[model samples]
Target chain A: AQSVTQPDIHITVSEGASLELRCNYSYGATPYLFWYVQSPGQGLQLLLKYFSGDTLVQGIKGFEAEFKRSQSSFNLRKPSVHWSDAAEYFCARIDSGYSTLTFGKGTMLLVSP
Target chain B: DVKVTQSSRYLVKRTGEKVFLECVQDMDHENMFWYRQDPGLGLRLIYFSYDVKMKEKGDIPEGYSVSREKKERFSLILESASTNQTSMYLCASSGGQAYSNQPQHFGDGTRLSIL
Candidate 1:
């Protein structure tokens, strides 16, 4: 079975500091990878996605994710974190022959000033 | 912008009561899905519909059912609500194409509680 794993349950970073959230997947080939953010009481917002080419993909809100086939990882990163960036981040993938996305357990980000 | 709308943002129900959760999409998407979100479970797919009157069982489909009577509307039914059924239900929609990837659009979600 295909699955997504987010090792870090929670991460805290200072404002203006760099942030990286790790994600690993259990699959044979590189499936469609995605990063989504969910604010308190809000639905998920797509940050970035990786399909076929370009290992490094840029997304909205200054977010970027690198899809590493060799590592079986699609990690999300941001250069400078703002206080408003505190939210839950989820890594998702659409495995082969699946129409729905399989999501990770999610990483809760806490921005400290 | 693609918009997926759930009928409720919060709901409270009693045990063994039948419950209905409605979802509507304005993007004219060909695919619709229902997922339940738990604190540590992330999101688990409950059901999916590719077209009207067509449904597919997802990862967790027990104690639940679905209805897709219209192209823009999909409903998830809890035949007998239980205390363990309390969860945040999410509705999503996406365009369908063979071998093509389309990102799903999500609604705000409905937080359902069974007592």
Candidate 2:
């Protein structure tokens, strides 16, 4: 079975500070990984995804994620945090044969000045 | 840009009422999915359709049913709405088999409140 685990339930960062949200997965193969963000009362928006290739993947809104094979982790990172970046982030992987996604509980990013 | 539209932004219904939440995608994608969002649970898939008239169960499909009579539209039904069923429902679409790599595009979501 494939599952995602985001250890951090919430994280607070100051503006211009670097941010990192950890996501570790349990999978046998190279599963498709994705990062999605959801604002309060809003829908989720795709940040980035890694199917294969370079471990470091760039996404919209200055967000990037690095997939580490040995670590079994795909942690989302942003070099410079902004107030508008505060939202719930979900890490998901497409592992099941049906191409369905298994998501983590999510990490709430709270940006503080 | 791919567009996914949900029929309502907010809804309120009484328990035992049969509720329908509609979603339509104009991108002509072959895969459509419905999910319910709850705090701390992330997103749980309810049902998904690969093509018209074809459906498959997702992670959480016990209290939900689906209809896909047309290619561009999918509907989620709550057989007997319960307070526990109240949640933020999301609809997503992606290109079929050959294009399965495409990311799923989502709608604004419908926040349903059951009384």
Candidate 3:
């Protein structure tokens, strides 16, 4: 079965610091990868997605992700994090056959002042 | 912009009672999905509909049923609400070819609590 793994369960970073959240997937071939963020009491919002294109894809909220086929990883990165960036981040991949998503357990980002 | 609207923001019900959660989409999307969000589980798919009156079971569909009588409306039914069923339910919709990769638009979510 195809699955997404987010190694870090919780990450605390100082405001204005760089941020990176790691994600790895188990699949034979390159798949459609996505990053989503959810704030407290709110549903998820799409951050970025990677399909058949350049390895790097930019998304809303000044975020971007790189899809590394060799590593089977699609990691999210931001140069400077803000206090408002504190939220839960999920990594997901489209199940090509079913058009459904398989999401990771999620990484909770806490931006400290 | 695609707008997915969930009927309630929060709801409380007793065990064994039937529960109905409503979802509507304005973009006339071809796909609608139901998922439950938990602390460690991230999001688990419950059910989905590709078209009107067509339903399919998802990863976790036990104890849940779905109805998509109209293209714009998809409802999730809990036959017997239980305490373990208390969760944050999310509804999402996506347009375009079923086989193509499309980002799903999500609602604000409904936090359902069963007593």
Q: Score residue B35 of candidate 3 by CA lDDT.
A: 98
Model 2, C-alpha of A9: deviation from truth (Å): 0.5
- Candidate 1 per-residue lDDT, tens place, B48-101, comes to 988899999999999999999999999999999999999999998999752346
User: What lDDT tens digits, residue by residue, belong to model 3 across residues B19-94?
Assistant: 9999999998999999999888789999998999999899999999999999999999999999999999999999
Residue B111, candidate 2: C-alpha displacement in angstroms? 0.5
Give the alpha carbon lDDT tens digit for every residue of B42-82 in model 2: 89999998889999999899999999999999999999999
**Alpha carbon deviation, residue A112, candidate 2 (Å):** 0.5
lDDT of 1 by residue, A1-113 (tens): 88899999999999999999999999656599989999999888889889888899999999999988888999999999999999999999987677889899999999998
TM-score of each: 0.97, 0.97, 0.98
The order by descending TM-score is 3, 1, 2
iRMS, all models = 1.8, 2.6, 1.3
Higher-lDDT candidate of 1 and 2: 1
Q: What is candidate 3's lDDT per residue for A20-90, written digit by digit as tens?
A: 99999997465889999999999899999998779999999999999998899999999999999999999
Predicted structure 3: clash tally: 0
Candidate 2 global lDDT: 0.92
Task: List model 2 lDDT by residue over A1-113, tens digit each.
Answer: 78899999999999999999999999666688999999888888999999899999999999999999999999999999999999999998886354677789999999999
Best to worst by DockQ, what's the order? Answer: 3, 1, 2
